[model samples]
Target: MDAAIESIRSFNRFFTRHVGAIDARFLDTDISLPEARLLFEIAQREPVAAQTLQAELGIDRGYLSRVIARFEQRGWIRRDRREGDGRIRSISLTEQGRAAFDQIDRRQRAAVAQDLAPLAELERDELVQALTKARLLLDPGAPMDFVIRPARTGEVSQIAARQSILYAASHGWGRALEVLEAETVAAFLRDFKPDREQCWVADLAGVIAGAVLLTDEGDGTARLRLLHVEPFARRRGIGDALVRSCVQFARDVGYDRIMLWTHTVLDAARRIYARHGFECIDVEMHSEFGDPVQGETWRLTLEA
Candidate 1:
């Protein structure tokens, strides 16, 4: 917990410094960061309630009142009484306020664009995904909308690399695991059958958050392989969604049953498989990945 807290604090400090949050005037504007943010939000939700602004911004009532009063003095904002409640006021940005908001918005956009200009397209997408994932982790209420599409060419190796890194960091697994994954993916692609095999990636924007591959295993059985979700992207239903996609694809392709191999240590993946009607059919102790682990085979029988 201490390490996690320090990491978060360090990131916060670095981000604030990089964005000039400590500056008296934000983005060389005439207002502080708080004031600029309030102005932008007001413009976004014009005729918004003062109470709503307070709730959204989590600012003290007195502080918000002072800010609103200052805006009124500057002729940048006007407040009108609600029809049913005279005490409740709706705030709107005046023409001058709109102009000020536009200027700040343009500057902010340009600043960010300039900062990202040096990054390649892939790197930029990765940065956006990382930022968005961090926001989602900190704010659970943040919406996460991702798509599960067929894996693109050259993406299989990326999936293998991500899964290998995640396992190595979390489970202390070695290069043997990565080698195994690479071989599995290689063979799956080498003997690819479009009609009987499929691979899907959970794409959060342009980022691949999770992936799964289904392969024909003969005798009307489909094998589910390389199921994984990025650490930052977990608990957002990406894993379960990928599993469901794989299962549905198997059923659609006339597979009689689906089977998958997983370690008992992976409780989350086990739970996802269980929720999808898979049952453990076999278990054995193995040290294939440099650790003695209970390897289990889970099977899901499809309805005819």
Candidate 2:
């Protein structure tokens, strides 16, 4: 076997042995491991549906039903049809079941604490730090595989509608949706030039995840506008990728700085801008569309 596979198998054996000791001491009842875990999960929620527990625990339906049936037969759990949802059955712990679970939970926590007692406080901290660093090293963010292409003529309308819905749902600004009209978006697309002002859409898996537009402000500065990402695509590093692409494009095209306007309500976008060395040089309270709002103007200086 490969060294990595051997290491994994060794770790699994060590873990199983460690857990088996506690299982022998605490699990005197006839309940199996799966049934005990199900009891703990169901006890945490009030009348939780079996399907919810299955999804959350990633257990197979057939196995989960068998375990639940055992618990039901032991008088440790009760199931009833949900109010107004006769088809959906909810599970809850009976009084006797709660007492059994309390005993099991205390034993589990005590066993875990005993196992960790060998490590000092500093050693535990070091272990956590090492694990976190390994995770980051293995999953460092990269420029996602995306194609930057000109916005399609039909896509402008859809983009505008989605943006409106997102902004309204997020910032509670219903009128902010009207700031970018369909005709204006169409004109922007129609007049895009690769050398001057341009709009590029980022497509991932045949879906437009984000977009950015760079327009020359005519004074050695480029206006970075329309940096938007779909809410579903948030935290996938799409926003950061779009911002970096725009910054690189600006620097390559002989621009001195890039500037953009955004609202303060969008903290995640602001953090991304700050991370890439963009400084908030100007901010003001103004009403551009309808209601008064706090807006921030960020600038990133490009190295000449």
Whole-model Cα lDDT of every candidate shown, in order: 0.90, 0.76
User: Which stretches of candidate 1 lie above 4 Å from their native place?
Assistant: 1-18, 83-87, 133-141
In candidate 1, list every pair of residues with a backbone clash. none
The per-prediction tally of clashing pairs is 0, 0
Best by TM-score: 1
Over 77-115, each residue of candidate 1 has an lDDT whose tens digit, in order, gives: 999998999998899999998998899999999999999
Residue pairs with clashing backbones, model 2: none
- Alpha carbon deviation, residue 40, candidate 1 (Å): 1.4
- Candidate 2 scores a C-alpha RMSD against the true structure in Å of 18.8
Work out how many backbone clashes candidate 2 has: 0
- lDDT (10s digit) by residue, model 2, range 242-296: 7888888888889999988888878888998998889998889987656888889
Off by over 4 Å in 2: 1-150, 181-187
Error of 2 at 22 (Å): 44
